[model samples]
Target: MKLSFNIALRFLNSSKGQTFLIALGIAIGVSVQIFIGSLIQGLQIDLVDTTIGSQPQITITSTSDDKLIGDYESRLSDISSDYEGVKHVSPSADGPALVTSDEENYSILVRGLSFEAAEGIYKTKERLVEGSLPENKNEVLIGTTLKDESGIQIGDEVDVLTSSGENQALTVTGIFDFQVANLNSSWVLTTLETAQSMFSYDDRITGIEMQVEDVFLADTISSDIQADLPEDLLAENWKDQNASLLSGLNGQSVSSYMIQVFVMISVLLGIASVLAITVVQKSRQIGILKAMGIRDSAASLIFVFQGLMLGIAGAILGILLGLGLAYVFTRFALNPDGTPVVPLYINPGFIALSAGFAIVVSTLAALIPARKSSKLNPIEVIRNA
Candidate 1:
């Protein structure tokens, strides 16, 4: 083993330029893999954060037109204690209503929530643009777009007419912007009690909104929740509600993997071809070694050692190159306000996986050339020389 390693080192050192070029090729391939993988992962994270960061992963709601979940408090308690991965569960009641201001009248959805529980699902307190969350019954928080369209000021009282033909005067205590224009324009936030009263829910909630520790696991958890609940109650997850988004993310991941696979294949081919040519150029030296009684297995191992060295050295250089590229991207790719356009999070496991695959693939690429080295005819080579 020592003899094989020494011979491999000597060969690589002797053909310094060729070895360097082959190593450089491998390095470039690996660096690109790291960069592309990290870029896609970061983009997916950002997309998810924007779309559902403040939204619930799973929701329990009534399936019937009554729009009321019976014994919701007990159900919520059961889910909180029994389900794994369940984070925060918030009960909310909402319904369509006519919200009229002095200047305009618009149809909008009115949502009622408990302050602390609502914060868990929507981060409502953090997103408050004006005033605080609804502190008492009939005091509501309005969406910014709704406020602007209706020409309603913070202290204005709005008339809310429920579907049941009941009219109630509600105070606009605060304004919020959820970033989604549709949500901002058509949603009114109120207290759980007020919503139940407005919707005639009478001691019942329309649904339970819940966030989970792992968003991706929401679907499975939702299925489990549904099984535990009655037939009239249904559980839905964010993934179910956003199928198109999940499809796009999956497609992006597949394409990225394909690109990385092709690049790795190219790197493997380059290393294999270089090692093959090296064997041909050094046939005479190999024949001499065989004639001097160096075993075929040991001869084969020389090329294997070369592969190991190249894989290790190149992968290290590739990791460093990848890190530098990531830093450059994050530094320069910024929004108008100076925040990163796409956040870059480099996982150590991903780096390790790339390097490990490169080393294994590079070693495998040397097998054919290594076998050729082991099969050289000493006498024939000497005669040819």
Candidate 2:
């Protein structure tokens, strides 16, 4: 085995330029694979973050009793104790309300929540453009779009008309920018008590909002939660709410796999052709080795060793190149605030998989050439020479 490896190394070194070129081709292919894989992963993460990073992965709401959930506190405790992925279970009371400012009325989604629980999912405090989360039932936090459209600001008192025909004056204590235009334009954040009082619900909440440790497992967790709850109570997950987004992500994955498969085929063909040419060029040498009593198995191993060497060397170079490309992109691709457009998180497992795939593909490409070399006739080759 050592002798076959040494011979393979010598043959490759003998044609240094050709060997380098073939390795370069492999490097380029592997580099593309790494970059594309990393890029796609980053994009998917960004998309998920934008969609649900500050939103509940699972939401529990009542199908009966006009959006009121009975014994929400007990239900929340049961869910926390029973569920595996449960991170934070926040109770919220939300309903449409008419907000009147200087004789102009705007319909908004008035959501009542506790700051501690709301912050866990929405990170509302972090996104506070001005002031802070409402401290009491009398104070409320309005979105930036609502502030701009209605000319409302902190310390301003606004009249809210609830669904039950009850009206109350609430003070805006802060303004937040959720970044989503619809949320910014329509959401009015208040306290659970305030929302219940306005909606005429005595100690009852509209629903329970929840965040999970694994966002992708929301569907399964939600179903389990639903099964554990009353028939009137239903659990909805992010996956169910964002079917279109999931479809798009699936399409992207399929396309990426297709591209990778084609790239591997191209790399395989390139290595195979080069090895075939090398076999023809080294026919006399192979015949001489065979005549010297080298087994066919050992002769075949020579080409296999060459393939492995090329794969290992090329994969190393490719990984370096891929990392460099990712770094360059992160540095150059920036937003107005100097943050990266898409964050690149290189997974070590993914890198290892890419390297392993390249190595295996290269080895397989050498099989045909190895078989031809093993079948070579020493007499015929010597006479032809």
Candidate 3:
């Protein structure tokens, strides 16, 4: 084995230009594959984050006519204890409300929540564009769109009429921008107690909102939660709610895989063709060695070892080049806000996979040349010469 490897190294060393060219080809192929794969992954992550990052991936709501869930505290506890993926769980009460300011009236979604618990999902505190989260009774946070449309601001009182025929004057303590136009325009966030009082629900909530550790796994978790719940309670997931978005994401992934596969095929064919040519170029040396009684098996191993060494060098170079390209792209591709339009999401596992994939493909590509070299006619070569 050592002898074959040494011979392989010597053969590659003898043709420095050829070796470098082959490695460069492999490097370019690997780098392109890595760049595309990383870009697609980052785009998918950003899309998912923008869609549901600060929202409930799963929700438990009642199907009864009143549309309110009683014993929500016990339900919250059960959900938290039963599922490890349930990262944040909060009870909420939401209903339609209208704000009458001057001669204009604006329709809004009045959601009552425990800010401390809701913080994990909504990130209301972090997303605050003004003032602070609602801390006092009748104090609430309005969305940016509402603030602009109604010309309302901190310290201003908003007179709200609820669907349940109750009226209250809410003090604006803060304003938040969820980045979703609808949410920004319509959400009037307040305390859970305030909502219950306004809606005349003694101790009940509209539903239980939850965020999971893995957003993709929400469907399975929601199904499991539904199976265990009573008939009147329904568990819903974001995947089910936004079917079109899920379909679009799936299509993107399929396209990305197809591109990667085609790239790999092209690289493999290049390596195989080069190695086959190498065999013909070194035929005389191989024939002499075989005539001297070096076994065909040993002869075959020479090309295999050469392939492996080339693969190692190419894989390392490719990884570095790919990483550099990704970094450069993110740095230059800016959004109006100075953030990368496509943020770099480096997955170490994926980088390792790409390197391993290139190495394996390269080694396989040398097999054709190795087989041909093993069958070289030693006697015929010398006689012809």
Candidate 4:
């Protein structure tokens, strides 16, 4: 084995250009695989994060005509205890209200939440662009668009009118942008106590908002939660709410896999063709070694060792190149606010998989040449020469 390896090294070292060029080809192929796989995966992650990761994955709402989920604390307790996947549970009272501004009434959903609990899902603190969260009944937070349109300052008083003729004068304590235009223009936030009072729902909330560890498992979790819930209530998940988005995501994943597979096949074929030519080019050297009583197995082993060395060299180069390309993309592909258009999401496992796969393909590609090497007759080669 050692003799075979040494011979393989000498053969490769004899023709440095061929060795380097073959490895370079393999490296380029592997690099593309890593880059495209990582890029698509990153884009998918960003899409999912914006669509559902930042928001509630599961929700519990009432079927009753009043549209209120009663006994929510008990339900919250059950979910928090029974479901290990459940990350955050926030019971909220949400309904429509009008914000009167200069003879025009702007309609918005008044959402009441337990700030600390809701923070896990909404990340309210991070989204707050001004002032602070509402801490008092008289204080509230409005969306950025609402704040802009109404010209309402942090301390400005907001006149809120309910559909049922109940009116309340509240002060704007903060402003937030949820990143969705509809949410920014049509949502108002306040504490749970205040919303319940405003809606006159004693000890009851309209819905229970929840986030889970895995966004994709929301449907399963929600269905299981439904089975455990009272008949008067139902559990809904983000997946059911966004079917088209999920379909698009699955399609993207399929397309990415297809591209990677074709790249890998091309790489294997390139390595096989190059190594086959190497066998022919080194026929004289291999004939001399076989004439010196080297076994057929060892002759085959020589080409296998060359394949392994090439695979190792190419895989390492490819990994570094791929990572560099991804880094450059993130740094250069900026949005208007100087953020990367597609934020890089690096998975160490995926990178490792790509490298390992390239190496395996390189080794397998050498098998054809290895078989030919074993079958070579030293006597015939000497006679021809």
Q: How far does residue 198 in candidate 2 sit from its true spot (Å)? A: 1.9
Backbone steric clashes in candidate 1, count: 0
lDDT of 2 by residue, 273-317 (tens): 999899999999999999999999999999999999999988998
| Model number with the top TM-score | 3
How many clashing residue pairs appear in each of the predictions shown? 0, 0, 0, 0
Residue 100 C-alpha lDDT in model 1: 80
Worst 10 residues of 1 by lDDT: 96-105
The CA lDDT of each predicted structure is 0.90, 0.90, 0.91, 0.90
- 20-87: candidate 3 lDDT, tens digit per residue: 99898888877887898899899999999988998999999899999889988988999999987899
Candidate 2 at residue 115, lDDT?
79
- What is the Å distance of residue 284 in model 3 from its true position? 0.6
What TM-score does prediction 2 earn? 0.97
Candidate 1 per-residue C-alpha lDDT over 87-203 given as tens digits, one digit per residue, 9 for 90 to 100:
999999989999887746799999989878778889888889998777788999888888788888788888989998999999989999998999999989999999998888898
Writing each residue's lDDT as its tens digit, candidate 4 over 1-385 gives: 9999999999899999999998998789878888888899899999999888778999989898998888888878989999979999999999799998877789999999999999999999999999999988867898999878877789988799976779989889999999988898898999999999988988999999999998899999999999988788889999999999999999998999999889989988888899899988888888888899999999999889888899889999999899899999999999999999898878999999999998898899989999999999999877776
- For each candidate, give its TM-score against the true structure: 0.96, 0.97, 0.98, 0.97
Q: What lDDT, from 0 to 1, does candidate 2 have?
A: 0.90
| Residue clash pairs of candidate 1 | none
